[model samples]
Target: MLRYIAFTVFLLVTGAAGADRLETSAGSVAVTQVVGGLDTPWAIGLLPGGAFLVSERDGNLLYVADGTVNRVKGAPKVSAAGQGGLLDVTVARDFTRSREIFLTFSKKQKGGAGTAVAVVRLSENGKRLTNLRVIFEVTPGGSGGRHFGSRVVEALDGTLFVTIGDRGDRPAAQDLQNHMGTVIRINRDGTIPGDNPFVRDQAARPEIWSYGHRNPQGAGLDSQGRLWVSEHGARGGDEVNLVHAGANYGWPVISYGTHYSGQKIGEGTSKPGMEQPEHYWDPSIAPSGLLVYSGKLWPQWKGDLFVGSLKFNYIARLAGTPLREVEQIKGPETERVRDIVEAADGSIWFISVGQGAVYRMTPDT
Candidate 1:
């Protein structure tokens, strides 16, 4: 069932005016609702003319403009079961001319359900979608409902990166023969990129870019165009990794965290060939969304990373040479932050699943 909280009570908890002014490490900022009355909003995308697209976990797409929210048609059918549904939406780089957008969802397949990516043209009026086409779908769809790591990101090089979880099949993460627990790199048309790390490996899936992830729900590109992912750990080892081509991120093998039952995880925390996380959380915050700030509005935040915590009801700000959590941005408005993105004007936008709303954060004068 979807979690619901009284918005009025939330506002009262913060302050008057339905906006919260919170002091952060950088400075005081105002958190205001952009839109509300949503149902389990999973991801958000910025559209031209200042409109927005918000995807709900139950297969509803919302178009919010001028304070009015409308349902958008033409989203693909989703499984909507156990952490699965319409997940992420991304606007095309040339959206002004292309009117195109990309979406990632848990598709119902022959075996059960798996993550899939589809592209569609938003109608000029923004009331519906057009020319919808499935670009890619996970092969060997699994039966379970948990751990569909389905965050889609457009790389600086124009290729697409889709994050997939272990699908609750731990051992599958270490096998390159399947798509589980891996990052996939593909062209816009859903074709495998020739330069993908495993494209030439006969025993590996050509689309595999990196492997051994747990449940990477958050992905973003930093200023230098490098991909970074924030993933859930078994019990307490949530991690933020600087993803590299063909790198093995020790999942069921090594971890700073152990099983929920306090049992030791595989072979300790370091293995010979497995990569270490840039940062990790021992107590586990259940991280969901990621953003690498450009600092257009706050210069001090440039090169810093922002992550949403589903379990903690806060946004984590991390920085420094070795990388660490420098601050926590939290309030009643930050409940279950599912996705975080930077607006074109450099303001921050995020989804609050607990409150069922979209919020924007801007520096206070």
Candidate 2:
């Protein structure tokens, strides 16, 4: 019994249960597709009550509980064109007591759409949201579908973290005065945090946390209170970066990848001032949502990072210090994964971008 127990412990430590995984260099088996009958699902906010709140790109918020999905009405009218639609949804940490929720989207505006992030108080039974207000908005307005600069996360200290896309205007990423291409730190109510790095830049927006990024679709905190961001590159060089406060991540410049027509992006890789990625993809996986595992369903997958690949149609189970890829949950061309959330019950929740379905990948056991 002692020998058997020792071997089990070893397996868990090495993360080698080898259950089923996306068919990649380190993984095997295809991801089982769950229910597939919704719109373009964007994000998943797992609630404290074990249910989930899902958002679609068409401005619809749905409540999913006990395996039933109910379309939530009264969502704000969003710009339903191109990349302008409802995006991420997240319930407040004290949602049970406060009944507040947070959302990020592309708000329709003159000429183009302005990126907006808001936190509102939800109804008692989660039917509708009241007191809706925009807490963050990208100024000078963006028109194209290039970048909305999204991803909202609240640290344990109650401060909120938000990412802004470069809005297809590369040079704006270097300008801390603009919200585009920045990670902003704000209070839970959409006010600026006093300790923010750019709070004193005088010329810079006070919300700026880090600047110079393309589109950081995925941003989350690790166990040690560090921030992890996954962003799409121009041609190659999709990157997973460790974000630091008030730092600069060179965008359109110093990228490992060049332009679509083989033009050099910037001053080439490795500049003096720009931060580098912990890991990057050469072919561009079009990475979107991200999550750090704190689950037990796949006992071996604890303490790792999982990202949903939109272009690759796979879920990358990355490992290592900053997480290199050890496995992938490719669905065999079944779905475009937008977000991956490890549920409170240890199940994997995959949100499909095109299919608009909420799939829960559970252990076959």
Candidate 3:
């Protein structure tokens, strides 16, 4: 069964009687509400013609267009337990011709639940989804619900990268036989990419591209087509990593943060084979959605990275050679930012779980 809601869209204006303005390092930005009355919205996909899609954590896909919000039918059945549920959504690169979209969610498997991906064609009317297909499913499902890590990114080579977490089983991150705590690459049709890191490794899963990740909730492609992810660490070690093929991110074995109980985790921070994060946050901000800005609208922010802070209620802007957080874009509207992205017109769009609304930010004129 699908649920419907009345959505309100505020007028886009700068300094227009009661407009929300956020001051930034570059300049002030006008924040306009795109839509409101959402429940735990997880991700947003901006389609052509100014319409957009929003996926709610409780298994509802919403299509907002022509000043109306309608429920998108045919979403896959989700576990919707603990930290797992319908998570990320990405529009197909050739969406105009294909009308296809991809989704990541926690699938209800035999033992418990695990992350999975599906591809479906949106109907021309945009009211329902058709041709639904389950493209990928994590093997060896876990018993608990924590750490689904369900972020999906489409690479420059027309392949897909799906991030998985340890499922609260820390040691499984080091094991290569299972899909837990790993990023897997696949073709749009769900076939394993031949160039994958472990394609020929008899003992490793053929779909594995990288391993040893804890709970990577956010993934994005930079301007240069490089992949990056925002990961959650226990206690204080939230990390932004430049993802590379076949590399180990050192989750349980090496972490800058300690256990939640205040005990030291792993053998210190640095290990020979493990890769260090490009940036990390102590006292954990609980990072989620990540975006590599194109600098189309804001030239000064070219090549900068934007990540939403789930715990701190802000958008982190990171730049420079070593990649450090340069600014925190925060206001009352940014509370519990779940996902952030660049719109077609170069405007910045983000979802705020705290506000239960979608907002667009533009340079205040």
**C-alpha RMSD values across all candidates:** 3.3, 9.4, 2.2
Best by TM-score: 3
State the lDDT of candidate 3 residue by residue for 42-78, as single tens digits.
9999999999999999898989887778888899999
Q: For candidate 2, what's the RMSD?
A: 9.4
lDDT of 3: 0.91
Residue-level error in angstroms, candidate 1, position 293: 0.3
lDDT of each: 0.91, 0.77, 0.91
Evaluate residue 305 in candidate 2 and report its C-alpha lDDT on the 0 to 100 scale.
86
Determine which window of 10 residues in candidate 2 has minimal summed lDDT.
11-20
Better of 1 and 2 by TM-score: 1
Error of 3 at 231 (Å): 0.5
TM-score of 3: 0.96
Predicted structure 2: clash tally: 5
- Residues 1-365 of candidate 1 have per-residue lDDT tens digits of 12223433443443335667989987899888887767889999998789999999999887877655667888899999999999999998888999999999999999889999998999887889999999888888989789999999999888999999999998889999999999999999989999999999999999999999999999999988899999999889999999999999998899999988999988999999999999999899999999999999999999999999999999999999799999999999899999999999999999999988889999987
Candidates 1 and 2 compared by lDDT, better number: 1
Every model's TM-score: 0.95, 0.88, 0.96
* Candidate 3: residue pairs that collide: none
TM-score leaderboard ranking: 3, 1, 2
Q: Which is the better candidate, 2 or 3, if ranked by TM-score?
A: 3
**Clash totals, every prediction:** 0, 5, 0
Displacement of residue 43 (Cα, Å) in model 3 is: 0.2
